[model samples]
Target chain A: MDTATTVLDLVGVFLNALLGGTVARRDRLDLFGFLVIGIASGLGGGLIRDVLLQHGPPAALTDPAYIPTALAGTGVAFLLDISPPDWSRAFKFLDAAALSVWASVGAQKTMGVGLGRLPAILLGTITAVGGGAIRDLLLQRVPAVLQDTRWYASVAVLVAAVEVLGIATGFPVAGTVAAITLGVLLRIVAEWRG
Target chain B: MDTATTVLDLVGVFLNALLGGTVARRDRLDLFGFLVIGIASGLGGGLIRDVLLQHGPPAALTDPAYIPTALAGTGVAFLLDISPPDWSRAFKFLDAAALSVWASVGAQKTMGVGLGRLPAILLGTITAVGGGAIRDLLLQRVPAVLQDTRWYASVAVLVAAVEVLGIATGFPVAGTVAAITLGVLLRIVAEWRG
Candidate 1:
């Protein structure tokens, strides 16, 4: 992957892990639970994307950097005293950032693998939301993707579509940045309006 | 794989789906929820195993028979008038059966793929309990695998270890049958005693 893409993905992982850790804390989970949820949230979406593409063992399992990055996010959550209600707005913004970057990267990777547009977009959306869905599941809550009327998953889909279109038209870098910006903005707007 | 293994896996899928459907019904979810939970419960374990193993697209998505079988299980749950109290005992029994079969089959598959014994046993347990965990998560309940004091996951781990040992010692068929029986008995006994 290009350095830009890699940077974006790492940022996404950290943000997602933060989101997971916060949720775990909210549920009164212990340290192990925080770590588990953090790692799963950070890497879960990418793992699902790779698996669907029949790529080798997920990068999360093979790469050494992933676990530590996730753990760092978890550590932040454990050390911070921010309550869920207090941080809810900031958390939404962070979640949207992670969602946008993951969607862009996931769709780009899928397209690079020569998958059809439909699967690429679908998988991209899956990649963006899969981690949080898993976090919610582990916390014994209905997944926000499935329950919320807000355009959470839709924003990811839109980002993926933009990424795919950019690749198809030979403007991949511009397309990715544009998609991420659009997705994050849409999510923030939706949350704000709601 | 072999016909015997295939049949056992199918049975596992059906029973897991039934368990998932019951949970969905209990949660008063709509039709989409029932199907989503049913499919996840039936195929979740296998999907997790396959992804970890880097096996191709999970059999649930590739094999036509899987979705139909899962759907059938959901249909039964939706149509049946069985009360939760009435089905509780029966559900436990069926869950044990599925656990036994899935554990055995998963361990065998992992070994066939040349994974080491430790991973084989762990993946086997994951295969047995993953679906139920997913079902519980979707239903907004803590997964029994993580919380229950019962020997639910422990039984599957034992079965997997036995299967791996059987393969190593050249008694595959007998070992599989014996492990399945032992697992089922352990689970049933645990439930009964509780």
Candidate 2:
């Protein structure tokens, strides 16, 4: 279970880093700026969640793999020639996937810590949308989750709600997976329709 | 000691919320936006600090008074006719005071948790600057702490350093108070010179 969670977490980090790097490139930020944005976007949500949950120095700060993974994602993003707008479809898919995984992970972690349903749900949403919000903020843009009418943060909220329900009713693992799948599909569908 | 700390904490929250509310108003955010920004700016630093230290739910969430204090600050900001730029001098003074208090409090909390020197200093700075950074991000501006050459974050760093040094050498309370005083003075001087 730990290994699976780790793998999913890395995938989410990589995708977020890519998004952050693309934003940096668009803004023509310095190399340091790119690194900062990439790392923050990749790990910012988890950091916020861990802090709110009273978890230790965030996993990103403690784990050896997280920073390198984020850096690799940023490097790939830097090397890529495709503009973010041109890769909107791919970005949307990756974003939704990452969001689903993060929301599930966050909800599970919060519940594991004995937090109540409301906190678990709130933390789940924060974990899903935090990195992107940080990325936009660094770039001096309003967070998409705040402004976009499409089901961005809403999808995470839904996933979190399902996770809490599943936990309360038993069958946590099954519920998490179902919620993730449902969230990704909803986000993609919303984006496509919009 | 607890009473003193609580007073300082409330003052810090009120000032930061005022700053957040002003930013929200300038950006033409609705009432909800005003509340969100106000609460985030007032509590963001402490939230980041407690998380890093593995502390329980942040005081802002646990203590009933904290939220209301922040709300009052926002309400006062909303009612005021003075624009942020127009009140720059007062804002600078209040910002400096808040920064000093938060940095000192963060360092003290880190030390109390038995964290080492480096983490104490780092968390201290985060506690001081995190709120303002969040405010800037929400307002779609580069964090002033990151971009401004001013002694803003630097002063916090210095205060944190002093705090750690004081703890390592003994005399924690005196060190914290001295650091706060020094940090506030340095910030005011820098603003005046700038």
Error of 2 at B46 (Å): 3.2
lDDT of 1: 0.81
Per-residue lDDT, model 1, residue A60, is: 78
> How displaced is residue B144 in candidate 2, in Å?
10
Cand. 1: chain B TM-score: 0.91
lDDT of the candidates, in the order given = 0.81, 0.82
Measured against the true two-chain complex, the DockQ scores of the candidates, in the order shown, are: 0.20, 0.25
In model 2, what is the error at residue A160, expressed in angstroms? 2.5
Fnat for every candidate: 0.32, 0.40
Stretches of candidate 1 exceeding 4 Å from the true structure: A1-44, A56-125, A134-142, A146-148, A151-194, B30-36, B75-84, B88-94, B137-140, B147-150, B191-194
**Quality of candidate 2's docking, in CAPRI categories?**
acceptable
iRMSD for every model: 3.8, 3.3
Cα error of candidate 1 at position A1, Å: 12
